[model samples]
Target: MASKQQTVASFVETAPPGELSNVVADIKALAPSEAQALAPAYKKYNEEQYITVKLPDGNGTAILSPYNSLDNNRYFDTATETSFEVDHASQKTSNPQPHALETPHADLLRNLHKALTTTSSEHFPTSSHTITPTNTDPSTLTILLVATKFSPQNFWNARWRSTYTYNPSTTTLAGSVKVDVHYYEDGNVRMNTRKEFASREVSGGAEAVGREIAKLENKFQEDLNRGFGVLGEGCFKSLRRQLPVTRQRMEWEKFQGYRLGQDIGGGRAK
Candidate 1:
């Protein structure tokens, strides 16, 4: 009779002899090529003590570690992987069967990705732009944007990130777009808003829908740029200052002098 197996609390914990033996057996069962493919992941997990295992399918990527709650007691990662494919427009053809209504939104995503990434503006260069299709009923798409000042000397390190979720309009129904924005400088601020567009806006074709959505995104980004500047100069300036009114670092040793005569020695010196 075979000995019973043991389970560790999480992947971070060392596998017991029984579990280790079983893992070894699983590895051995794979074909030679497949076993060879596992070498890199094994080495990475062994050395770094953590690893994110990307699914072979393009749908998403997974993190296999204790941090992920789904894998707390199992060797396999059960948590859903939510990922966006950067510039997914070019790879859209890979989908065997796409919904009839997705084409216009695909165009919108592609246009947004192109316009943002191809700009030469030094103010905020495009860092990343990605799109993920949310296959829920009344299909929708999510677009993520990241723009940053790419200079090493720029201490402020200004960054603008936004997420836009688009709901396509049917023949009789108007559609809506929801946007969430995060702008970072000395401090960060966030804004969320939604807008509805008439069905006529997207009625022309894919190109029309793409153009309309791109226009809305550009306007929203510009508004946030102005808003963030105002906030940094007015409200956030004091919080970011390095020195007090003396224009120098506080002298902790001298601070005790003020407390020499008070209870807890916090008053002026006698």
Candidate 2:
């Protein structure tokens, strides 16, 4: 047996089983009591302070502690938000920014003229002139000009009429043109011209008129494009027939009325 007690090695000595188990149990047991004692103290300390109460959605409100008993909460609503700030001294309030001027009737008229002159395959036959508003009110502007003439005969046989409606509310512009043509046996033509009555109400009020004018002006260009396309097709059809180009020339001439010449042969040549 002595010989069999060969060398046995142990890395370290171990305490008897359960020797310090009671001490470990005591430490574990003290942790809960310590935590409980600290809980009340923490509650008491925080009771006198202001705190931010957070909601599940992450929005929070300031709240006074129970011990402090002060009205620390402040809430803001849309109507009472920063945008509603008022200057008491100046008796003024803030409002959202307004939109910039986007459309103008003058611009639209120019575009329509350009489209009619170029796309209709006619030299700048149409002329436009501006009529200033007699009143100081900028909203009361008027434009007067003779429409294009389609035939040379329009010089002798033409009658002209103009009608329009102006609305200060919506800044809208609309109107129509009607032309009558008469041809003589001697290769001459005449035009009787009339404009349809139209009007628009500017929806955004007086302050918005300028902007609406701008919008209408842009739309005017689009309308001119469409109008010219149709007019071009019709003119092309007539040209194909090789009929007396009298009526067409007369209508073009009507547009040149007042602008081109004082009398038939006395006017400036195109």
Candidate 3:
């Protein structure tokens, strides 16, 4: 009997020209249908809890049952929040519907979110603000600004997304800034930075944390004002001109001496 690999090799060797290619094309054609069928199964498995158990009366037989399902119930809803303990530290995360931000920490995030929106709107008129992961402590506040110029007629798009978080318990302020410039000619420039600032006061109380928040707000506002200028300069000039080498504008003046009418082979132009 031929081995599996040898059998495949023999089939490939004996097939007419393009038969192997046709087989590969057919497989590629089925990928979309396979992916479509798999996507829902993946989502369902992720959202539902199940356990596989062996049957006592049969060999290689098993059944998947909903975890902790009631015998009288046909369907069960899984818990929204997951919790685990690791080395005395308990961590919990929730997957629930969006809710309002009402905690004191959320109040601080809301204030920062408002300020960031005000700051970014100055440079980018088309900007959006959102507070993400409303369930997490010290929720992330993000502002995204997008700008596109039609000088090249839909040849490029640029965007800047900035995220900030303040933790009152730790007296720390964190910022993540990202800039992306994508060109239609298969070119891109990306810049990202993450930094944290701590309070300088010896007392790590509410007043100290408040001061840190005020200072961070001011500092970030100034950075936004200056950073937009720097990004504009960097993105449109530095890397944008260098990538997709075919898009560069040639310096005709520098090559004037090598042109047909110019001096060549020790002979001057007439």
Candidate 4:
């Protein structure tokens, strides 16, 4: 049998450079508690991290870790090789919901605008999102939001896109990912970044191309979650009105509200 050093050396030889510890952990099949021991020594490993470049020419590459979500849980379009991690407001939803900034709309919109610009970052580590507004031109302001997902254990990162027009109360978001492995794409995913571009196409069936699409979707979800937090609590609450509650339901809702307050803070009893 190979010595421990030789075994680790073999793993180091096959795995990506600078990830010897990660490979060794996999080979050793350490228990969860045991794995915890190695965490501190290899905190910065990039074995699970990914960097996808949106090429200006419409062909891009996604090289990184395997995604955790699969078809059963998330959304994907294999024909176009694109995936969606959070379809929270998906155009495909059966009962599509519309969310907006809360009352005192101006203040909310201003806050959201600030949040989008300040917290959101661009695809590459070095770049960032851009906002364009025209007061003299008499056009609505344009805000671009970039969302990302990064998993340290897996060492992966992903990027997704969304846009909002506050005046119109409109939001449009789509997800994306990159691939360097062999797979057939029915078409490329057209996108606009520092420049407009698309994905490169390849051909392969579900079994062969499934994982790539899944991982890409995983990254898209991760990146997408990074956004929407800057607007503060209850920022995206939907609007609804209370109906005439036939006297009985009215009393109940009122009592329920009081009870809720009590539960929250003992009805603010001093």
TM-scores for all predictions:
0.34, 0.24, 0.36, 0.19
**Model 4 regions more than 4 Å off:** 1-109, 114-131, 134-138, 152-155, 168-270
Per-residue lDDT over 1-270 for candidate 1, one digit per residue giving the tens place of the 0 to 100 score: 421121111221232211323444554464333443443334333222222333435554333322221111222222232321211111111212222323345565455445444442333443444444543432655444444342323322233444445555552223444444444456544455555545443455434544555666567668768987998898878676476444656566777654536533345666
> Residue 145: error of model 1 in Å?
7.1
> Which residues of candidate 1, in runs, are more than 4 Å off?
1-200, 238-254, 257-270
For all candidates in order, the CA lDDT equals 0.40, 0.33, 0.37, 0.33
Q: Kindly list the per-residue Cα lDDT of model 3 for residues 104-215, writing each as its tens digit.
A: 5545555554554455455555444443332344242222222222223544545444444444555455554444444544543333343344423324533343344446
The best-first sequence of candidates by TM-score reads 3, 1, 2, 4
Q: Candidate 1's error at 88, in angstroms? A: 20
Query: For candidate 3, what is the TM-score?
Result: 0.36
Worst 10 residues of 3 by lDDT: 83-92
Q: Rank the candidates by lDDT, best first.
A: 1, 3, 4, 2
lDDT of 4 at 177: 31
Report the Cα lDDT for candidate 4: 0.33
lDDT of 4 by residue, 1-270 (tens): 985544444444444322344566675574444433433222222212222223222343221112212332232221123343322211121211222322334343354434433343223343223223322221333333333444434444334443322232332222233322111134322222222223323133222222333344455546544543433234434322344433223455455556544443445544
User: Lowest summed lDDT over 10 consecutive residues: which window, candidate 1?
Assistant: 86-95
Q: What TM-score does candidate 4 reach?
A: 0.19
Off by over 4 Å in 3: 1-31, 34-98, 132-152, 169-171, 186-270
Error of 3 at 1 (Å): 30
